[model samples]
Target chain A: MTKKAICFTAGKLAELGKENIPDELLSGKGLVYSSPATLAYNSPGAEGYGVKRAGLAVPESVMLIVAPGCCGRNTSLISNMPGYKNRFFYLEMNENDLVTGKHLARIPEAVTEIVEFLKDKTPRVVMICITCVDALLGTDMERVTRKAEEALRQKGFDKTRVRPCYMYALTREGRRPPMVHVRQTLYSLLEPMQKDPRTVNIIGNFAPLAEGELQRYLTRAGVTHIRQIGTSESYEDFLKMASANFNIVTDPEVRAAAEDMNANLNIPYIELTRVHGIDRIAKQYSAFAAATGIEIDDTEEREEAWEAVDALKERYPDLTFNIGESSNCDPFELATSLVRYGFKVDEIYATLSPERFVYIKNLARLSPDTKVYCNMEPTMIYYDMSGSKADITIGKDAGYYCPDIPNIAWNTDIKPFGYQGVRDLMNSIASKLEEGRA
Target chain B: MRGLRKVLTPFAPDQSGAVSVLYSLGGLIVVIDAGGCTGNICGFDEPRWQGAKSAIFSAGLRDMDAILGRDELLVKKTIDAASRIDCKFIALVGTPVPATIATDYKALKRMMEKKTDLPILTIPANGMRLYDEGEAMAYRQLAEVLGEEGNENKEESETVIGQTPLTYGMDYKDVSLEQMKLLGNSKIIAASASGVSFAESMGLRYEAKAEPAMKYLTEDLKGKVLVCHDEVFGKTLRDNGVDLDIATFFTLHDSIAREGDRKISEEDDFTKMVLEGGYDTVVADEILRELIPDFKGKFIDAPCFAISGRH
Candidate 1:
C-alpha cells in the first residue's frame, strides 16, 4: 500500500493566527480583500478573476484596502463607492523601502488607525487589507495586527475589531483563484449566524453574478433572500445574509467558502455550476430543487431558451463551434452538450482544469478520439485555416489571432454562476450566431 | 505524443519572439534580432571583411602583432586618420568590440605616443545590459583610460547620459546631479544632463538615480579616506534636518561607498517603485520575512499594492 503524506508545514499554514491579528472581533465576524496583478499573464487572453474576486464573499463594509501609492492606484472603482470610500488608505514607499524592509512596522499602526477611523460608526466587523508586499517582505501581518489590537484595547477603545485580509495574485489556481478564497472567508463568517427558516445564501458571487437571469430564476422558483456580493446595494447589507437556511454554490470557486460555512454553521450547500443549454440547465435546476425540497418552475425560462437555440440552429446549420480559452469547462463536455442540441463542436482551444480533468477522462470513455487543443497552442497549424470549417468561435482574444472566424466575447473575469449562466450563454450564442448569419 | 508532435513538427510557426525595430528611452535606437552573432567565446572563424583596398594591404594582422602593438600598416592608417579628421580633438571609443589584454593596451599606448601627437582618448562602449552600472563602469574606465591630461582647466559641465547615442533620460541625470550636489558640495557640470561618462572619466563625480551603485562604489574606496558618513536624504527630509557631505571629483566613488546607499541608479528607482511596490502588498508577512532577511522598518506602501502598477 502506498502511504499518502502531507508536505505543508504547520508554521507556514498557521502563520495567520488570532494573536497576530489587529482585531479579534473582525476575524470573529469575517472579512475579505483583493489586489490586481501588476504584470499579469493570461493564456490566450483568457479572463482572470484572480484580483477582482480576491475578497468576494466578505460582508462588504468590513473590508479595508492596504497598498502602496503605485499599486493601489487602479482600485478607484471600488474605493469611490459611497460605502467603501473610508475603507481605502495608501502608504507611500520609495526605493529605500525595498532594500531596507523598514515598512514592516507600519502594518499594525495602519490597521489601528483605520479601526479608529471607523470607531464612531464602527460595524460589527473590520477587515485589514494587505497586498503582495507582505508576501515578499514576509511581514507577519496577523501578529502585527494582534499587537496593535492589544495596544488599542488597552487605550480604552472597545467594541471595535479588525482582521487581516490578503489579496495575492500569485496563488490563483485556474478556477480556484483568490475570488474563491474570498468566498470561503465570507462563508466562514456567516457560519456562526443563526440559520433562518427556508432562506438560502447564494455562494456564486466569487466573481460578478449576472443579475438578469439569476434573479429571474430565483424569483420564479420562489427562492427568497438571494444575496449577491459584488452587486450588493450596500456593503452593510451583507450582515443580513446569515438569515439564509441554506446556500447554493453556482461557481466552483465558491466551494471552499461554502464548505467552510457548511462545516461550521450547519448551512449545507449544493454545487450547481453554470450550464449553457436550456434542457441541461432545466435538468440541473430540477435536480437542485429535488435535493433542497424546493419547487422550481423553470418552464417559461426553458421554453424561451429553447426557442432562442432553435432559431440559432435554423440560421446556421453548418456553423462550426470553436471555444478558445483556458478554462476548467471541458471542451468534450461542451461538445456533448451541443450534440444534444444538434450542433457539432468541430474544434476547441482550451485547457483542462484539475476539476474538469475527471470529466475529460470520462469523455475519453465515450468518444475515444476527441480533438482538443491547449489554449496556448495554435489550432490553425494542425487544422489548416484555409480548409477548416470553423465559422464561429466563442472566447476572449481569439478573434485577434483568428480573423477568418467571427467570435463572441462570452468569456469574462468573473465566475459564470448557476443555471442562469446556461440561459445567458444560450442567449449570447444565439445572438452571435444570428448576427453572423445576418 | 501530442506534445512531441507539437515540438517536432517544425511546421508549427511562432511569432512570439519575432524581432521588431523598437524605439525606447535613450537617444539610440537599438535593433535587436535573434539567431545571429555566435563568435563570442572562441576565436573568430571568418577573417575581417577584406573588401576594402586598405584592409587588403593589412590583411595579415596576428595576435602577436596586436600584443606587441607593432602592426605598422594598421598603426599607420590609424595615425593618419587621427591627424586627418577635421576636428580640434579626437576621442577613442574603447569597447568590447575589439578586446585586447591590458598589456596590449600599454604597448599600443606606448606605440601611439611614439607615433602621433593628436589627443587620442579611449572610452568603453559596453552596451546597456546590466542597467545603469554599465554606464557608470564605462565612464569610470574611460576616465582612467584617458590617463593624466596636461590641460587641467577642463570646463565644469555635467555630461548627461541621454544626450548622445549612449543615452537614458534627463530624469536620471537630474537625480544624479541632485545626489552629487547633496553629497558633493561642488556645482554640477550640467545639472540636467549629467552623463556618467564625463563625470566618471573627467574626475567629476555625479549622483546615481535612487539606487546604491555610486554609494557602494564610494564606500569601497575607504583606504583613500575620501568619503563622508552615510545618511539618507529622505530620512533627513522627513525629520527636517540637513545631513551634508562635501566630496571632490577625486573622492566621489569613495563618498558613494561611505554613504552605503544601494539606490544610486535608475534601475533601483524603477524596481523600488514598480516591482517592490507590488510585492509589499500581495504576499503574506511571514513569507516576506523569509524572502527579505534584512528587513527592519514598517511597510511603506501597503495601500499602493491594492491598485498595482499605476502610480
Candidate 2:
C-alpha cells in the first residue's frame, strides 16, 4: 500500500508550495476525507447552537442539559449570550450515577421541581438535551421524558410537556446530523389540530423569521395565520401551528422533522434552501407558490432586492470576495452566485457536502483556481491571505481567518429568506464595506 | 446534594483540565472522542482559545468507528494529521464512549511511537470527573515524559509550575504573575501544584475550581523542599503581613508531607490554625465563606472556577 501525502489539516496551497506537492496528490484515488473541527471550527456556525441554547428558541421552553461535568462546562460562556441566561438548566452526571443509572430516576422529580420553582411563567416544554455520555450508557431518554411528563401531571401541572433532544456528537458524521435530529425533536411537540387551509407554518430555526418578504408573500396569498416555531410568544401559539395548511421547511436541516410531521400529522411540507442569487430566489419562490397552489405576486419586492445588488455592483465593479461557511447562506451556492454576478470571488472557506457538488463543480469551472478549504480542518490555523487582492470579505468565519481586512459578518440570528433576505444581506455588506473592518 | 449544580452546568471535567495544561505547549492535541468534547474544551473551558494558534482537533468519531473499536483508523488519522502539521508531541484525551468500550489507547500509543518518534501521552479521561483531576493526571503524565529536571547547568530562578487557566479563570495569566511576584524576595522558585487550594495558599482570592490536583508534587517525590504556601509567605508579614502560604485542600489526604504548616482538616480547624498560628490575614475565594463561616482574619479574595458555577 502506497502512503499518499495529502493534507488532512487545512493549509493554503501557496504556503505548501507547488514543488513539494506530488503529481498524484489531487487524483481521485483510494483516500478518506474527514473534518475534525479546529480552532476556526469553534466559531459559532449553523450546525446548531449549544444544547443549552437549542430548545430555548421557544418563548417559555427551558433546556436541561444532562452530561458529565466537562460536557456542560462550556455552556457558561454561551449562557452569557443574549436570550439564553435564564432559560438553560443542567443535571451533572457523576461516576456513580452514570454507572448505576441513578440520575435517570431523579430526572422526573427534577422536572417537576423546576416547573414549581418557575411558578409564575410555567414552561410549556422542558427540553432534556442528552450528551454522548448518555449515548454510551444507552440511556433511554424517551422513557425518561415519558416518566417526567407523568410525574409532572401527578404534580398538577397537567399541561406541561417534556421532550429529549440528542446532542450525539458521535453520530455527527452519520446519515442524520445531530442538528437534524434536534430540529425533528423540537417540531414534533405540536400535536395534530383541526385543519385550517388559509394558514402556513414556517418550520425550523429558533430565531424568528419576522417581517421578511416571505411573510408578505404569504400574506398576499390570503395566508391569514403564518406561524413560526421560534416566534411563538406562548405555548398556546406554538400549539396553534398544527392547524396550518402546509409546512414550509425553510432550513435544510429541518427537512427530517418536517417529513416526520407530514407522515404523522398529514401536514405536507415544501422545502426551501436559503440562497443569495436573485434569479434562483425567484425560481424557489415560484416553486413554493406552485407547491401550495397559492398565487404570490412578489414582483415589486424581487425587483427591489435586485436593484440593491445592482447598485452595489455599479459602485464597486470587479470586487473580489471571500465567503465564510457560517450563517444561513450556503457557501458554495452563494460563491457561485457571486461569481455569476461578475464579482471576483477569491476563495471560500466551507465544508463540502455531496448535495453542494453542483455549485462546487460549476465554481471550479468558472474560476478554476478558486480555493475551497474546510474551516473544520486543523491546518486552518495557518490560513493567511495577506497578499490576496480581495477587497472585502463576507461571513464571520471569513472575517476571523482574514483579519485586518474589510469584512462583513452578514450574520443575523433571524432566518433570512427570499427577496427580503437578498436586500438584508446586500444592505449589510454595502454598509459594512464603507467601514471596511466592521 | 451539596455540590449538585442542578441549574448551573458542571465547571469542567478532568479531561479538559488535562488538555489545558498541554495545549499552550505548542503541540497538536486531539481529543479522541466525538466532536462535542473538543467543542467544550477549546470553545468554552480553555480561555486561551481566542487569538491563539493551537492545533487541537476532534477525532470526528462516528457511530461505526466507535462500535467496531477502530483504533487503526484513529492511528491513521492521527498520523495523517501529524504529517501535515508540525507538532512536538500528541496527547489523545479520551471521552466516555472510548472508556466504555475500553479502547486500548496504550496499544495505539505504542503503534504511534513505532510509526514515528513523537512522544505519545494518553490521558484516559472518561468525562466522569471534574477539571482538577484531569489537570493532575496530565501534569504527571507529561512530567514523566519530559521530566529531565536538572538545574545543574540552568539558571535556578524562582519558578511557578502549572500556571494556566485550568487553575485560574480568565485572569489566570495575571493572577499567576501576582502569586509568583510575592515570592520574589525569597531565595526560592515556587513551582505551583495543580489544584485550586494551591491558589488558596496564594490567599483565597478565588474559589477552589475543583478538588486539589494531587495533594502536592512533594520534596521527597522530586528531591526539592516543596514547602506549604504559608510557611514561605507568612514569615515576611508580621507588621506588613504578606501571607506566604495559606495551605488548605478540598480533601484532607491531599496535604503534602512538608514540616512547617499543619494540615487544615475542616472549617473550625482552618479558623484555629489562622488565629492561634499567628496568621494575621486569610486569603481565599469569597465563595469559600459558605464553607468557612467564622473568618476573623483579614480577608484577601481569590476567585476559583470550580465553586463559582452559579456566576
Candidate 3:
C-alpha cells in the first residue's frame, strides 16, 4: 500500500481592526497619548517602557504605568522630563504578585484611584498601561478595562473614559505588536471627530523628535497641515487623521500601525526612519519627496550639516571606529556613512534584529572582511585595545565597558534626529578623538 | 545516600575504639563529567590533572610509541604514575569523552598494575547507580592494599568520609572565605583531596598501624555518636548522645543586620532559648516515649524552614 502523509492546508488569517481613534481628540475636546518599550529588551530599558507608557499624555492628563518593580524603577529618568513630570503614575508589582497573578486584580483598582485623583480636571481619557505581566497571565485587559469604565460611570464620571494599552515586549511577531498597539490606543481617542481633509497625524512616539524639527521638516516638505502625537495637538486632532493624504511613520516598529491605518482610514503612510549622516539623510528626504510627490528645497540648514561632516572627515581621515548598538534605524547605514567619510569601522557588536539585519547584510556585501560580532558572543571583550584594537566605539552601554578606550555613546537616550543629528554625531566623534589624542 | 550507606556498612575496623562519621553519602561518585551531569551523578573529587601535573609520565606512557593507539601507553602510564607516587595503590579514572569512546580502562588498569607490582582501581565516569557502589569499590581497593592482615596492625585510627559542608560558599558573598577558613581550622582526621590520581593519594597508610598515638577521622560527620572531641573549644556533646540544640536558636544573630524593623534584644532572646529548648526537648522526649528498649533512630531530623526568616 502507498504511504499517505498528513498535512494541513493554509487558510486566510483574519485581519484585526486599526486602533480605535476617539473624536474628543479630533474635535479639540481632549488629548491623546502613547508610549513604547525601549529599543532593547530586559534590564533598565524594560523599566523605561513603564515611563514611556505613563508619560504619553496631554497637560493635566492622568496615566498609569502598571509593571513589575524591577521594570518599574526606570521611570525616574522619564519623571525628570519637564513636560511629563507630574502626569505619570506607577504601580509596582512584587515577586509574589508576579507568580500568584494577584496583580491582575489590582489593575481596576489602580484605574479607579487615578480617575478619582484626576477628578478636579475631568480627564478626557484615563489610559491604563499594562506591561508584559498581562501577557504571561493571559489577562484580558480589555475586559478588566470595561469593568473599570462601568464602575466609573456608576460613580457619575461620564466624561472620563478608561482605555487599555498593552506594552507586551514578548509579542513582537504579530502584525500588531504592543508598540503599534499603544499608538492605536492613543489615536483611538480621536476617532469620533470628522476628518479634516487637509490635516495629517504623525503616528510615532514624539520622544525621539528633535524639539520642533519633525513639524518643521513636514512644513518644509510643503505639507502645511501636520500634527505629531503627544505634541501640542489635542486628542481631537486624531479623528481628522483619516482625511490626510498619508501618515509619516518616523519609527520602524510603528509600521504595523501605519498598515492598519492604511487599511482602515485609506491614508497612505511613508516610512522615513531617523538617520545620523547628512548626505544619506538628505538623500532619504529626497527619496521621501519622490515617493510623496512633494518638493523640498535644500535649505541652508542642509548645507551646514554637509560642511560639518566634510570638515570632520578632512581633519581626521585615519579615525578607526566601532559600531556597537542596534538602533531602530539602520546601524549599518551609520557604519557605512562613517566608513564613506574615510573612517575605518574596525569592529561592530550588534544583534541580529530582523529589521536591522538588512543593514548588516548590506555592510557584509560592501565590506565582507569587516569583523562583526553578535552581542552575546564572548569575543566582545577583545574589542577594547587593552584587549583587542578599537579606536572608537559607538552605541548603547558600550562606553561603560570600554571606558579606557575613546568611546562615543551614540545609542540609547540620545535621539539622533534630523540633519543636525548628522552634524552632532560627527562633532561628538571628533571631540572624543581629539581628547584621545591629547 | 548510597555513598552514605556504604559508609555505614560495618567495615572490619582497621583499628578498634575509634569511630568515623560522614555526611549525606551513599551513592555513585562519578567524575570527569561535562555540564550536563549535575545534582548527583558527578561530584567534586576530580584529580588535579591540569598542565604537566597530570599523571602522564609516572603512569608510564613514557615510551612515546603508544600514542599511535597501541593501548599499551595506558597500562604503562598507570603503572608508572602509581610507582612514582609514595602510595602503593592506584584508581585510574576516565573522562567523559573517554567514557563515551568506551576506551578499555578496566583492561588497561589490570595490565598496568600487574606489571608495576601495585593494585589499580577503575571508577565508572557515567551513570551513578548508588553511593555504596563507589565506596564499596574504594573499600575493596583499600582492602587489597592494606589487607586483613595489614588492618590487624592498627592500634587506633578513624577514617572520616566526605568533607563537603551544608552550604558551599564560592567568594561571591561575604563570610564565604571566613566560613571556609573555619571549616579548614577544625580538627580534620582525614580527607580525600579533590583531584588525587593514585590510590595511595586517597589516604596515606600509617607505617606503624599498631601505633598507640594514632587516631582515624572521617572527613564528614553526619550520624555518629554526638561527642565533643575538644573541651577547650566546646564539649564533645557526641559522648553525651546530644546533637545541635535545634530549639536553642534557629539562627545566629548576624542574620538580622541591616533589617528595617529588627528588635535586637527580643530577637536575641528568641534565638537562644528556642534553639536549646527545642533540640534537647525533642531528643529527650523521643527517647523517653519509645516503647522498645533498643529503639534506634537512624535518621537525623532537621528543620529546614527554621532558618528561612532569620537568613
- Number of the top candidate by DockQ? 2
- TM-score, candidate 2, is 0.81
Model 1 residue runs over 4 Å out of place are: A1-48, A56-87, A92-102, A114-126, A129-140, A148-160, A173-177, A206-208, A211-222, A326-332, A353-371, A376-389, A412-420, A433-438, B1-311
Chain A only: TM-score of every candidate?
0.70, 0.87, 0.76
| Candidate with more favorable, higher DockQ: 1 or 2 | 2
Candidate 2 Cα outliers beyond 4 Å, as residue runs: A1-48, B149-155, B170-302, B305-311
What are the models' TM-scores?
0.51, 0.81, 0.52
Give candidate 1's root-mean-square deviation (CA, Å): 21.3
DockQ of each: 0.02, 0.30, 0.02
For model 3, what is the alpha-carbon lDDT of residue B262? 20
Please provide, for model 3 over B1-311, each residue's C-alpha lDDT reduced to its tens digit, 9 standing for 90 to 100: 00111001111111000000011111111122111121011111111111111111111111122223345644543343233333334454332223323457667666765697655555543221222223334443443433433233232434332211211011001112122122222222222111011113334331111111012122223342221111100112322233332221111122211221121112223233333322222221121222223334332222111111000
By DockQ, the better pick of 1 and 3 is 1
Candidate 3 docks with a DockQ of 0.02
lDDT of 2 by residue, A205-310 (tens): 6777757888887888888988887767788888888888898887778889888888878889998878888898889889888978878787898889889889
Give the C-alpha miss distance for residue A51 in model 3, angstroms: 6.9
